[model samples]
Target: MGTTQLESVPEPKYWHLKTVLTEALDSEFSVGEILPNERDLAARFGVARATLRQALEQLELEGRLQRRRGVGTTVAPPRMGVSVGTEQHVWPGGPGDAWQSVDCTEAAPPAAVADILETGRDEPVHTVRRTRMSHGQPVAAELLYVPASSVPDLSAIDAPAGAAHARALLRELHRLELEGQDSAVELGSARADDAKELDRLPGAPVLVVTTRYVAGARTAALSVATYRADTCRLTFGDSGGVEIHHPHRHAS
Candidate 1:
């Protein structure tokens, strides 16, 4: 794409520049290649530095580019296709699950989670942390909350704390018949904890997928998952179903 002065286009100059830069990225740049400096890019595109910066920011939000600390901006890889359909009724730590259990602890849940669990606001629950990976890269993080009532059979002898306790809690949860799962997807900024887990900056855009697992006429478990917005493509299933699919699954 040749650099053409954008003085008369009906659309905003920066929007037009974003289009041109996108074309150039597809045709001229490879994945992980660092882009030219802002000054050079502005000169090459015949746009003001501010306009070029706007275009670059937009591309980054759209998953076309990445700005890394000390690494500069680079071409981004293909967005991973993630399915958020709710058609199946299953436990969290079932066989073939993509998310790996990280740690488990007993702590008081947030008020909102407590409300969902129908427990006292200050009541402590079993909180399990998990993470998902693709191509050896962190793609999502999750916090699974299981109330004591949900995993009554979990014992210290059967499983200790940390990841072992997490697996045990999941196993105990499976004893109850899974009535249904409800999930909601929304765009949110990454909190400090989520950012560290996903290797992103605080306040970076993220896709929050909240799920409630129902059993025995109550919400037995709650899952709040944060997926990297820049790398995940969420597709809702028909009839308001929710499932998480990783298109780039590796063979075991």
Candidate 2:
């Protein structure tokens, strides 16, 4: 265990703790390395356990640490980046897409999802859970809802159904000229189920991307994708390599 007395700064103790811990994580830790127990860490930092825990919580939320029951906290690997864009819209199984369906079942859409799908509150929709991995890391988990009417030929799908079947259904459905798509991104916390899939604790910070696909004049499908935020920078529009200018800074 390494020890260095952190100088007392005017900032809040928790903030300072977070900074010191972050630097330590960057310099002395590798992904999946177990951190020293909180008691030892506090003793080394000369701070209270509560302060150390607060910093740890923030780091966990940012996908930097994993805290498991009976196991100590460990450093987390980088998150994956999944692009959300308006390019050629194709079926889920198309080449180059990073999503793979995990399971599919019939369920009533959540109230919010029902509203967006423009279906009755009790209407049953095919819910497909998909996990997207990039660079060998799990990045996003999605719940895709497809109305029965949109996929009338689902009976032909094979048993032991999963990504392959979901892909087939999507390919057939895409015959209906997907004309356009609209999307919205917002900050959200990972729900219990999603947290389990993403290997993080519940209420972890995430970027929720909701997309609606239109065929003709009607909404055909809806996809809600939750992405790990700390390791992603959601890019939009053309990939113009322009440098962003900061108005607050002036050249000396």
Candidate 3:
């Protein structure tokens, strides 16, 4: 037989690497699986270390990979979907509610929060902190601020102070007939406290959802919720329509 050799295929330098890595994550890797170190992976792929790192970084931003300081990169799980809307609703606190009241405080609302409440910067407000757990995993931290003016008769409420007080304040708020609500979403990094609450390292990417509740021509309350970008998808409106996936790509 005559000796014959087939031509070698050139390895793609960029997008193709991403595709290959994504497919590997889906087919072969489980969530939280630590990937092979960059140098080893590069050698195995016959690509430069820089090229491999670039692909990894892209995956990290898209929430498919999580990189730790001492720990290496690992496969990330899919984000959970939480609804954000203006519709009058109550926390179900039932099987699928996924929210738990952690702690509460009475303090002056921050300048930004006060501005949203249409109150003075140093005005006293009830601050309620809640942690939202999806599938038994912490996914978000919420700071709810209710101005005193919104709940003038809180003294008669029987619940303990702080979170209980905040919950009472919410009940009073519901009495006014929620006229409407406005919400804004922006990209943010988790703060130290919020990061701890969400069980993520500081500076981790988050999606901030700011909401203002209105009742009878007055701004009632302000809620600032920080959701882990790697593990949550904030859904608004009815979810019956076409599925709009996350902005980033994920392994199928």
Q: In model 2, which runs have C-alpha deviations exceeding 4 angstroms? A: 1-9, 69-71, 85-88, 133-138, 159-164, 230-232, 238-252
Alpha-carbon lDDT, every model: 0.85, 0.77, 0.75
Model 2 lDDT per residue over 96-141, tens place: 7678878778879999988887888899998878987754557789
Q: Scored by Cα lDDT, where does model 3 land?
A: 0.75
Which regions of candidate 3 fall more than 4 Å away from where they truly are?
A: 1-15, 32-40, 48-51, 67-73, 85-97, 161-169, 244-252
**CA-RMSD of model 1:** 7.4
For candidate 1, lDDT tens digit of each residue in 129-176? 999986556889999999999887775446777888888788888889
**Clash pairs for candidate 3:** none
TM-score of each: 0.82, 0.76, 0.74
Q: lDDT tens string, model 3, 149-187?
A: 777887677888656665666667666666677788999
Please report the candidate that would top TM-score against the real structure: 1
Candidates sorted by lDDT, best first: 1, 2, 3
Candidate 1 whole-model C-alpha lDDT, 0 to 1: 0.85
**Highest lDDT: which candidate?**
1
* Residue 114 displacement (Å), model 2: 3.3
